[model samples]
Target: MTRTSQVVVIGGGQSGLAAGYHLRRLGLDFVILDAQTTAGGAWQHTWDSLHLFSPAAYSSLPGRLMPPQAGQEYPDAQHVVEYLADYEKRYELPIERPVRVLGVHRDGGLLRVETDSGPWRARAVISATGTWWRPFLPAVPGRGDFGGRQLHTVDYRSPKCFTGRRVIVVGGGNSGAQIAADLAHDPEVTWVTQRPPRYLDDEVDGRALFDAATARRRALDAGRTDTGGVASLGDIVAVPSVREARDRGLLKASPMFTRLVPGGVEWADGTRAVADAVIWCTGFRPALSHLAPLQLRGRRGRIATAGTRAADEPRLHLLGYGDWTGPASATLIGAGRPARDAAREIADVLA
Candidate 1:
């Protein structure tokens, strides 16, 4: 069946919902196509004990404030999932689930969104698919030869299963740090990072980190050369569990290993450590496979975007792909601006 709309938002996650909110406010005829059968986007797949670095107030989408969980300091993944589901229900956003978009191709004056269900002809398409689907694992020598189990963060559920096992957690990002901390109480776990892990002060959490990033962005936009007090968000925040782990001296990270050997990893100094399993905390690439038909990806495999709109394709906008799409678009709080702006642009064009 062929369907049509003034705008077709290609995801039903936080970013897509934010954009839909604005589009509805503008009275635009639109639909949101979500690949997942349920709500919550990638938060559904995160580890069992995963919690947001920021508190509920700082981690909310536009229009509605995420309510704080009773007696909980930091909202966990399940809390986020329930909130997302409730948000969709509260706003009455038009969402089509389990409709996996296969590809997007230009169709004369309109854009054709080819999906498993059918093709959607839209005046504009918003590609809000986030990075969860595209997990990135760096190629290490003898990776295939390693007889032990290896799993990326996407497949990770809990550290309970890894009891009494020696595991190597690779990457220095928040996920790496959090996962390492989660496993600290269990069997031996080693964290490997290319550089030393920067531990932010106790008071500084995701909110402070985001504020610093916003300041730096503003400074750069104003063409200022000096950003003295700005700190990168790459540093690990002192979350409660992480802080506890640090107190236990379990937050110590080691230098990255050279290659994967049978049953374990080999370091640069010609030393090998035997391991029962390896958990790759490596991050993800943007989930842009469906957009490949557009041929818009530039250097570093990212789409060349002007604000949220595609630089080459004016009728297309991308959201929640990280800083490249818009500052903090990947976060719950940050996605609103870009989404609002994208919807406005699309509405203007359709007008």
Candidate 2:
């Protein structure tokens, strides 16, 4: 079956929902194609202990503010899932689920979205597929030869299964810190990083980071000297759990290992530790495989964009991948602006 609309959104997550909200406000006909059978997007798959670094108020979608969770400073994964599910319903966004998009290709006057269910033809297509589905694990020598289990952030659910085991947690970003803290009490964890982990100030959180990004963006727009944004600050946020672990001296990080051995990993300096398991919180690449047919990606493996519109293909827009799409566009609070801009641009183009 072939369905047609003014716009077709390739993701039903936060970014897609935001795009839908704005598109509906502009009275544009669109449908959000979501791969997942249910709502909540990636939040439903995050570790059970995962919590936002910001308060619920700071983490919200357009047209609605997330209701505060009772007795929780920062909302947990389930809370976020509920919020996303509710947000989807509250706005009555048009969505089709369990529809895995195979690829997107240009079709003379429109874009054709090929999905497992059917094909959708739209004047414009918004690729809002976020990064959660693509967990990145660095290549290490002897990784396959290791005798223990290995998992990435996407595969991790909790530390309960690793209890009483010697586990090695690798990476230096927020996930690495949070997962290390989560396993600190139950497992003998050796947190290894490329360098010492840099922590944002105790007082800093997502709101501060978003504001910094916004200010920096405004500065650049005004043709002023570039002021540092979130990148100028450190990486890890001092969430309660990370802070508690830090206070207990359990967050100490070791330099990254050179390679994995049969029993564990070894450093270039000849330091080695035996471990039963390794948890890699290495991070993720953008989930853009469905956009492959367009061949818009540059040599750097990213699509060049003028705002949300693809620089090479104006009929296609990318969203929610990272800072390149918009300032803080990946976050719940930050997705709105870029979504609004994309909707308006698509509307203008279709007008």
Tell me the TM-score of model 1: 0.96
- Give lDDT for model 1: 0.88
Model 1 stretches astray by more than 4 angstroms: 226-234
The best candidate by TM-score is 2
What TM-score, over all chains together, does every model reach? 0.96, 0.98
Off by over 4 Å in 2: none
Q: Which pairs of residues collide in candidate 2?
A: none
lDDT of 2 by residue, 1-351 (tens): 898998999999999999999999999999999999999899899888999989999999988999999999999989988998998898899999999999998899989999999999999999999999888888899899899999998888888888788999999989999999999886479999998899999999999999988888888878997778887898899999999999998889999999999999999988889999999999899999999999998865789999899999999999999888998999998999999999999999889
Each candidate's lDDT (Cα)?
Answer: 0.88, 0.92
Q: Highest lDDT: give the candidate number.
A: 2
Error at 9, model 1, angstroms? 0.7
